[model samples]
Target: MIEPRLIDTGTARLRVMVEGAGPLVLMIHGYPEGWYSWRHQFAPLVAAGYTAAALDVRGYGGSDRPDAIEFYDMAAMVADVIGVADALQPDAPVILVGHDWGAPIVWYSALTHPARVAAVAGLSVPFTGVPTRPLGDIFRRAFTDRGRFFYQEWFRAPGPAEEEAERDVRGYLRRLYYAISGDAPPGSWPEKPAGATLLDGLVDPDPFPAWLTDGDLDHMVAELERSGFRGPLNRYRNHERDYAWAQAWQGQRIGQPALFIAGTRDPAAFGFGAYSDPLTVMRPHVPLVEGHMLDGCGHWTQEERPAEINRLLLDWLARPPLRL
Candidate 1:
């Protein structure tokens, strides 16, 4: 069982779920997910002889939610990671594992504060080094410029997406989660013109996939209901600001041992990543990098394939660079 505690990051208080005791491995969840997203890996990580700490990122779950959009920027989030690590294990640099938006967060943490992060692994998203342009501009040029629908563009504004998501949190979560999962058919995400909203054409599966149970959906919905969507959606609104802040480190590489995992079917792995070859794009920045693309897997890497991810993680953790 995992023990829950609140970690004071000085800037924000994050609710973290921890298990076992050894070298610390801090896991950060992405958008719309809490510490519970990493629940499947805790036991296996502990059995492999490591302390597994999964945190609900600021603004999600019980974590502190700051009001300003700028508070959720990449720099601020990286500070939270460092503060949490400082509190959890002061003597040694800690391992960091993140997924989705959490992927970029951990990537920036390692990039900006190399001495604080020993090794980093990201699921579903790969680190392609510091950005030269804002992500919003990239997506707009690719999608909105061509009159196509991109979810991030829909999420660019704060109000409408929140209303749609908060109006029926359960339904919104079900569709949002299912549409991008492995179980969904190709194009299950739906095709729409640029004018459409994010949830305009998505469908909720009659019976949700086994990986995400009814109880799981219930827990996620309940969390969102309490926290609201402003803090989470605000993350998307900061692309230009994040890009500006990252310019100082424009040509820098991670300079750490790194691992990347993604599903063949996951759009984020390819579409959003804007590359057919992830390792190629990642290697220049993360020289000592290892990657795996799970067959038929989707966005929710650990959740959908816990056993596989656990084995891979254990094997990687035991590698010479990361081995204690």
Candidate 2:
């Protein structure tokens, strides 16, 4: 794997790794992960005649880590991505692929800066329109107030989450990756009752899941240990602010060719609120929306099923669609 070099986005300096030379494909990764998360797809995308570039989002890895939680807001995150895209190829639209938080970043970037994005693909997250209410309130009502545990709430606090996770990075990564994988042991992911911690009921599997290797865990841990979990966890504290910022674009559509992929076992695909039907929710905003749900896969869709993902991407990108 090639080492990532730094690129100065107008708002933030990001560490980016590029492969091949052609139309640009800017990849964004999710929470608790770095540019390394998208390493598998870089060569394949380049082989298919596209410039595949993956970058470290702010607050993770080699990117700038702002101290305040507000710096990690969706508004700033969107600006960072737009800046990166513009810096890579000014005024030239690029295809975007993102998973987890990166998914929301690209999705919102498409809406806010439609001219900068030619085509967009979101993994593990679906664009379900602007929320009428703040997500924190909703989550609190559904989980916290109901005497249940919600991961976001547990992460909303700045220091506590960071302390626990950073204190035991290995344990945190192992338990987190395993619990969300396709092979989570039976009863390994039961719902936590009211007043339970995020780590409650989480099991760190014996040999780790097949999708993730010991080497991969080490890499993630090394990067995460450099800059505790503060910046990453701060993202959870901005639900109200994000909803407020998104109000300006209420009822706006993506108006670009888009692809959505998610693992059937991923909670974002079906377990969450009213997000079970992503296509139905996306068609209104993106007219050219095409999607696939991989069976037996989990949160790490690209890593868990790289070959199939490469084939799907090659076929889709080669086919007629929006281009700049």
On lDDT, the candidate that comes out on top is 1
Which regions of candidate 2 fall more than 4 Å away from where they truly are? Answer: 1-3, 271-275, 322-324
For candidate 1, lDDT tens digit of each residue in 128-152? 8887889898899998999999999
The lDDT of model 2 is 0.84
Q: How many collisions between residues are there in candidate 1?
A: 0
Q: What is the Cα-based lDDT of residue 239 in candidate 1?
A: 97
lDDT of 1 at 273: 46
Q: What ranges in model 1 sit over 4 Å off? A: none
Please give the TM-score that candidate 1 achieves against the real structure. Answer: 0.98
Candidate 1, position 71, lDDT: 94
After TM-score superposition, the amount by which residue 73's alpha carbon in candidate 2 deviates from its true location, in angstroms, is: 0.8
The digit string of per-residue lDDT tens for model 2 on 1-324 reads 454678887667889887787898999999889888987898888877788889988988888998887898999989888887787778589889999999989999998988889889999888877778998998889888988888888888777788889888999888887777777754556688866666788987797767778888888999999977888888889999999999999888888888999887888765365566777777887777899988878888888888988888777888776422
